[model samples]
Target chain A: MANTETALKDVMSSIDGAIGVALVDYNSGMALGTLGGSAELDLNVAAAGNTDVVRAKVRAIELLNLKEAIEDILISLNTQYHLIRPLTGRSGKGLFLYLALDRSRANLAMARHQLKRIEAELEV
Target chain B: MKRTLRQFTGRRPPVLIDPELLAGPGLLDELSGLRARVPHLTGSLVATTDGLVVAHDTRGLEPSGVAALTAAALGVGARLAEATGQGEFRELLTRGELGYTATYAAGSFVVLTLLAGPDANIGRLHLEARRAGRRIAELSDAVLARQDRD
Candidate 1:
């Protein structure tokens, strides 16, 4: 099992063009761990704010009657790609990994694949 | 379209239905009916914003604690929506390894929470839950209105 801090560190370096990364608790809107955000990006605020994104989507899934599990939620912008991956295993419940990547340099498919691997290895 | 608490009142409304009224067979029947109509619904309950359990049909879980957590989640959900310009908070759903928990705003004072397996039909759950929520609101509102008169 990968430690929370170590796993987050791995995510920052392993994912290309990673501007910032945070492990957020949707339950209380708190960031359990964070790495690599610039002054323009407030990692904690980003983490906390995304809790609603995770929540809104989950509710939407229920409302829409979709039985599928959330693989990742992607929000694309002019310069950035915000990727949210909700951890699924028993230990990972109520938490998700938030990754901010530069759209120009990052590959979306690869980033998602890496996030899934990190989620599987992550202990909590 | 989602309904905000603002539609009911300019301010937060107090719990109108008494605890005794919550435990009434009428509400219990409504909850049971919702569970029956919706596939994969393992349990259901109604709780106040502060986490007080008004009525429940939960199995193998502590109704009181779940009610309180639902209130907490609702608070965060509502604030998050407003802050992000996502509009009013209507419902919240969280998936776990074992199952899913979905909470809906029943009315001004109480929220309806439902539990379901991963395979449960998400569409049906919402449809049935919302219908039950309307009845719950009417029943609770009427009781509170009567109390105000007395």
Candidate 2:
């Protein structure tokens, strides 16, 4: 199975317009690993902060009694597309992969598809 | 020898230096800071190499028990590393179905241990933990270095 470093490398190299990526644990709001961020976008801090976003969505699902699982969450900024996907694998519980893409250059659908594939092969 | 007999008496004070005494409150802060840096980490601990609790940020688990186990593991790991010509023991990591248990040698006298969720990224854990381990070793050893400033 691809480890965290290799998985992140694939995410950055294969994905178009990828700005930054992080694997985060929502429980304690830590970014286990981070890659590809500029001074304007510190991936570690940015991803850790998104723990709140993931937690809120999970809580909302529970409170609403919507038994459906979250496939992903998206936030579109002026120039960036932020993607958050909670891993669905048995071993990936409580972890999510965060990716930021350049809105102008990224094909959102392909980025999402690649992220999903990478997550599947990720063994932690 | 009198020194050898003193050991059998089992009354000698344990620990050369208290982790808290050597590092003080900053030790706790170090542990807390690590908890913040690493994601999905349940907790972290720093203990004497011989199985004494120093500073810990763990939850719902016995720090002393883990400390004791750390000593046991360290002994075996050190020997295994040496026997296999791996040089000095640096770190060890194991994964279970649900989580990870990682150990890093902080200094000659202490170790750092961490427990993280299953999805915890191993690469990130190593990066952060190695930094923490070096910091702890320096913090603790600085005290001894001051005394030995001959």
Candidate 3:
């Protein structure tokens, strides 16, 4: 199993146009680890805001009364792509991998594929 | 099309209830209306923050099991998101070989789950679902309040 930090670093380096990457806890809206964000982009605040998004979606699902599993959430912005992937493995429940990329240089399909790979190898 | 939550609740009594500071009744009609719009959307559900089933379409699936699974997934997803330092998780989508499953936020009180076949148009589905989820949150808040009044 890949250590969390090394696994994260590998993903960051492999993906082009990756502006930032983080491991976040949707439950508490906290970032356990982060890399590559600059002065204008604060990973902590982004983690909290995204937590709201996750919470809201889960609530809506309950109201509708559907039975399904969530894999990943992709937010396509004008110039960016925010990918929120919920870890499904037993060891990684309640955790997610968030990746931010510049649209111009990022390949969404490849990015998603790579993230899944990283998730498989990550050691929690 | 528009339907009132009163009309829906009158027709189908909710399966469960939990009181809290949240949205109200108008939200339910909006959820029903949303269900009406999506053709391939097999079902939808709302669960509390702790992952209890609040309400559901319940076409043929087990409501409690779904809620438990969603809650478990949410826990893992949240942890993975934090471990990587990417920030808070906004949503999660699982694309299985057979179908697709998605979870979205509905304020602080609930989570929305959408299950669709391979043919479902993801882009359009996401847009409509998000709108519907918000409407439900508002309705849930109202419903909780009405119960309080009684």
Instruction: Say what the RMSD of model 2 is.
Output: 7.9
Tell me the lDDT of model 3 at B34.
Answer: 64
lDDT tens readout by residue for model 1, A38-81:
99998877865677677779889999999987889999999999
Q: Which candidate do you rate higher for DockQ, 1 or 2?
A: 2
Better model by DockQ, 1 or 3?
Answer: 3
All candidates: DockQ: 0.02, 0.07, 0.03
Could you give candidate 1's per-residue lDDT for residues B86-121 as a string of tens digits?
A: 877788989888778999887667789999986655
Candidate 2: Cα lDDT at A57: 91
State how far residue B52 of model 1 sits from its true place (Å): 0.5
Fraction of native contacts (fnat) of each candidate: 0.00, 0.00, 0.00
| Cα displacement (Å) at residue A59, model 2 | 3.7
**Per-model TM values vs. the true structure:** 0.51, 0.59, 0.46
The 10-residue segment with the lowest total lDDT in model 3 chain B = B1-10
Best candidate (score: TM-score): 2
User: Comparing only chain A of model 1 with the true chain A, what is the TM-score?
Assistant: 0.96
DockQ ranking of the models: 2, 3, 1
Q: What is the C-alpha lDDT of each candidate?
A: 0.81, 0.81, 0.72
